[model samples]
Target: MRSIWNGAISFGLVSIPVKLINATESHSVSFRQIHTEDGGRIRYRKVCELEDREVGQDEIGKAYEDADGSMIPITDEDLARLPVPTARTIEIVAFVPEERVDPLQMGSAYYLAASGAPAAKPYTLLREALGRSNRVAIAKFALRGRERLGMLRVVGDAIAMHGLLWPDEVRAPEVVAPDAGVTVRDQELDLADALMATLGEIDLDDLHDEYREALEEVVAAKAAGETPPQAPEAAPPGKVLDLMAALENSVRVARESRGGETSGPAEEAEVRTLPRRGASSRWTPKETGGKKSTSTTAKKTTAKKTTAKKTAAKEADGRKATEKKPVAKKPTAKKRAAKSAQPAERSAARSTAEKATGAGKSTGERSTGAGKSTARKTASRKRSA
Candidate 1:
C-alpha cells in the first residue's frame, strides 16, 4: 500500500525519516442511488443555496465555522500556500507514561515505517530509548494543512504511532449524583471478587464485531433480491430491587448455563449437595408434585425390571410391554440357571464383597489376615456345597 503522507521523526537534531499516517481503522458501506426502472446512476451535483445555480469543482472552497455561526472561506491555493509546520520533523513536546493518557483521547493507530534511505541507527536508538524509559513521546506535526497530534511508543518490539484528539475536542465528564442509600457488605464484596477471579485472562483477539457482520449479511440479502430482515427489538429492563441479590442471582444463572456448555459429562454428573437437617422446610404442594413426577419414572423403571426378572410369566409379559422401547432384562432361563448358580453367584458376590470390605477397611489387622482367611473358608465351603 502507498504511504498516506511523507514525513520524518525528529528528536533534537536527529531525524529518523519515516512516511505513513492518515490510515482509517474502519470502512463504511457506500450505496449508489439508481433509477428504479432504467437502472441509470442517480448522481448528485453541488448547488449554491443562495444563487440556486449548479457549482463546479473550481468554485468549491473549505469554510471554517466560528462560535457565532460566522463562516470564513479558505481556498485550496491558500491552504497549499500555508507554510508547512515541521513537515520533516516530529518535534517531541514531552515524555509521559502510557497509562497517564486517558482512553478518551485515543483516536486512530498507524504503523511507523522507515522510508527510502533508511536511518537504521537512529530508529534503533529511538526504539531502545523509549523501551528503556517506559514512556511515550508526545509530538505535534502537520498533514494535509491540518495540525495533527500524535504519540510515539514502542509496541511489541516495533514503534507504533497513535493519533490523539485535543483535550478541548473531548467532551467533559458530567457530574453524577451519589446513591447514598447504597451500601456494600463484606460478604458481597468477597463474592464479587470471587466472580471476577473466575473471569480469566484478557484476549483482545477473542472479540469480534457482531454488528458489522450482521450488516454485511443484510447487504448480501439485499443484493440477492431479498428484503433485509428487521432488527431484533430491544429487551426491556427488569425492575430494580435488592440490586446485589439480583446481580448475584444473574451471575449464578449465567455461570450455570456457561458451565453446562464447557463442562465434561463426568463433571456434570456429580451429585448436588443436599441441605443440612432443619436448614430447609418440607416441600410445598407445588414443589412436592414437581419433585415427585421427576422421581416417578425412575421408580417405575426399577419396579418393572424387578417384576420382570423375578418371575417367568411376568418376565414374558414385561418383555412384550418393553418391545416399543427395548431394555436388556434378565432372561428366565438365565434366572433359573442362576438359582443353581445363585449359591455360586452368592459365594462369588460374598467373596467380592469381603475383598472390597477388606480393601476399604482402615484397620490393617482385621483386613490383612483374619478377613482373608474367613472369606476364603466361606468361599471354599460354598463352592463345595
Candidate 2:
C-alpha cells in the first residue's frame, strides 16, 4: 500500500525517518441504492432548501454553528491558516511499559516503514530496541491538519503506529452491578473451572464471520441470477436456571465434543473437582469408565427406566380392575335369590308348626258345637225308648 503520510519518529537525540500506511482494510460488502422493481440505480441530486432547486458544487461550503446559532462558513484556506501544527515529524513524548496503554484508548493503526535506504538503519534500531525493552513510545504528530496522540510499537519485524484517543474523547462507562448478596458457590466455581479445563486455549483458526460469509454467498447467487437459498434457522439459546448445573452440563458437552481434540500438557494436568450435594455425577476424571462415571446419557437412561416402571404400574392397575369384573359377574340372579329365600321359607314353616304344638287337640276337638250337643242327643233317645 502507498504511504498516506511522510514523517520521522524522534525520541531523545535519535530521529528515525518513516512513512505511514494503513494497517488494516475494510472487508465489508458495499451496496448501491436502486429501484427494486425497475432494476435501475437511484440518483440523488443536491438541492438548496431555501431555493427549492438543484444546487451547484460551488454553492456548497462547510460551516460551523456558533453559540448564537449563526452559520460560519469555513474554507480550505481558513483551516490551513489555523495555529495547529502540521509537522512531518512524530515527536515521542514518553516511553512506558506496553501494558500501561489501554486497548480501548487505541484507535486505527498504520504501518510505519523506513522512508529511504538511509532511514532503514535507524528504523531497524528502534524496532529492535523496543522489542527487547518490551515497552512502547507515546508520541504526538500532525496528520491531515489535525494533531493526533500516537504510540509506536514493534509488530512482528516492522514498527506499527496507532492513533490514541484524547482524554475527553473516551466516554466514562456507567455500570451498576448486583448487590454483594449475590454469590458464586464453590461447586459452581469448580464446574466453571472444569468447563475451562475442557476448553483449554482458544484457537484463532476456528474463528469465523458466519454472517459475512452467508451474505457473500447470497450476493454471489443473486449475481448469477439464481434464487438464494434460505438461511438455516438458529435455535434460541436456553436461559441458565442453575449455575452449577449449567456449568456441569457445559463441561459434559465440551468433553463429548472434544473427540479428536488433544489437550496440551498444561491443560492435561488440570484436575477436575466434583459437583455439588453428591458424588453421583459421573464427571470424575479418574473413575469415568467405572460405575461412578459422570455421564449425561446414563442419567437420561435412568430417567427413561423410571418412567417405564411408572407406566407399567398404571397398566397393571388397569388390568387388575378388568380381572376383578369377571369374578363379580359369577354371582347370577337365580343363585342370589336361592341363597336369600331358603332362610325365609324355613322361618315361615317353623312358625306354623309352633301354633299347632301349643294346642294338644286333634282335628275333632276343634268342632266346638258337636261336643256339647252329644248329651242332648243321648237324652232324646232315652225318652223315645
Candidate 3:
C-alpha cells in the first residue's frame, strides 16, 4: 500500500519513525451528474464572488468567514508555522484499555509501518507491549492540515491507528430514545433474544457490498447494449401491529434460511397480543390468527382428528364382526330337569336317614333303609310312566 503520511511516534524519549497507510478502501459505484435531455456532463466550476467569473484551481484559496461577514485568508504557510508538535510527530498521550475508546469517535483507520531498520525494533516493541497489556495508546497526530486524536493498537503483528474525533466534537445523544412511558415486557424480550439466537453469529469477512455488485452488473449490461437485469420487487412494509408475531416470524425465517431446527426458546414462544399505538382493542390475535402459527395448529388438529376417525372405524369394524359370530348356548330343559330330580332324591334320602336315626337304628341300618326307599320310589315312578 502507498503511504499517505510519514511521521515519528513520540513515546516518552523513544522516537519510532513510521509511515501511515490507509487500512480500508471503498468499492462503491460512482456516477457523474449529466444533463438529462442532452447527455452532457454537468460540471462545477470555482468562481470568485467579487469577480463574478470562473476561476482556476491555482487561483482559489481557502478563507475562514467570521460572524461579522469578514473573510480571513488562512494560507498553508501560516498553518505550517503554527507551533503544533504533532505536525510531524504522533505524540503518545497515554496507554489505556481499548474499551475506553468510544467507537462513535472512531473515523478513518490506517496501518503504521516501521520507516527503516532503526524503527523496526521500537515498532515491534510497542506492538508487543500493546498486545501483552491488552491496551491501546492514545495519541495526537496531524493529518491534512489539522490535529486529530488517535488510538493506536496492535492489529496482528503491526500497529494500526484509528483517528478519533475530539470529545467535544461528539454531541450528546439526547432525545434519541423511546418515550419514557413506553415499556417492554419480559415475553417480548424473550422473543427478541430467541430471534437473535436464531440468526446467530456471522463471519464479517464473508459479507460484501451487494449493492455495489448489483450496480456493477447494471453497468456491464448497459455497456454491452443489452437489457439490464430487473431488480426483484421489495416486499411492502407492513405496520407491525403485533410485535410478538413479528419476532416469531423473524426467528422462523432465520431458522429456515439456516436450514436448522427451531431453537428451544423459539419453539416454545407463544403468541402474545400487545397494544400497539393507534390500534383498537378489537384488534386481537383471535381476529388475525390466520397467520403461520394458527395454520400450523389447524393442520395438527386436522391430522389428529383424521387419525382418531381411522382408529374408530377400525374398532367399529371389529365390533360388527364379533356381533356376527354365534355365542355358546345354555343346557337343554331335560338335562336341567334331571339335575333337579337328583337334588330331590338326595333330600328324600336325608329325610329317611334322619327318621331311621330317630328310631335309634345303627348307621348301617339307616344307609340300608335310605337306599331301599330311593330304589322303591324310582321303580314305582318308572311303572307309572
Best by TM-score: 3
TM-score, candidate number 2: 0.61
C-alpha lDDT (0 to 100) for residue 302 of candidate 3: 100
lDDT of 1: 0.67
lDDT of 3 by residue, 1-385 (tens): 8999998999999999999999999877899999999999999988788999998888878789999999999998887677989988999999999888899999999999999999999988899989999889999999888899999998888899999999999988766766678878997798888888888889999999988898899999999999999988999998787888888788878888989767658685445556767988675644443455777689999999999999999999789547634321111222333344557654654565445435532464455455455546654664565
- Which ten-residue region of model 1 has the weakest summed lDDT? 263-272
Q: For all candidates, what are the clash counts?
A: 0, 3, 0
Candidate 1 residue-wise lDDT, 258-371, digit = tens = 563332112222222334567644553334423667677799999998887779777776775677232122222223333454576756645644564445426544454544
Backbone clashes, candidate 3: 0
Deviation in angstroms for 46 in model 2?
4.5
lDDT of 2: 0.72
- The deviation in Å at residue 94 for candidate 3 is 0.9
For residues 1-385, what per-residue lDDT tens digits would candidate 2 score against the true structure?
8999886888678887888999988888788999999989998999988899999899898888999988889887876566644377789888899889888799999999999899989889889989998899999988775788999998999999899998788876655555567878776676667677778878899997788888999999999999997967999997665665566566666776987353322223233343678666666445552446557769989999999999999999798658646433422322333344446543443443344335443642343233224324433544565
Q: Candidate order by lDDT, highest to lowest?
A: 3, 2, 1
Which one wins on lDDT? Answer: 3
Clash count, candidate 1: 0
In model 3, where is the ten-residue run with the lowest total lDDT? Answer: 327-336
lDDT measured at residue 241 in model 1 versus the true structure, 0 to 100: 51
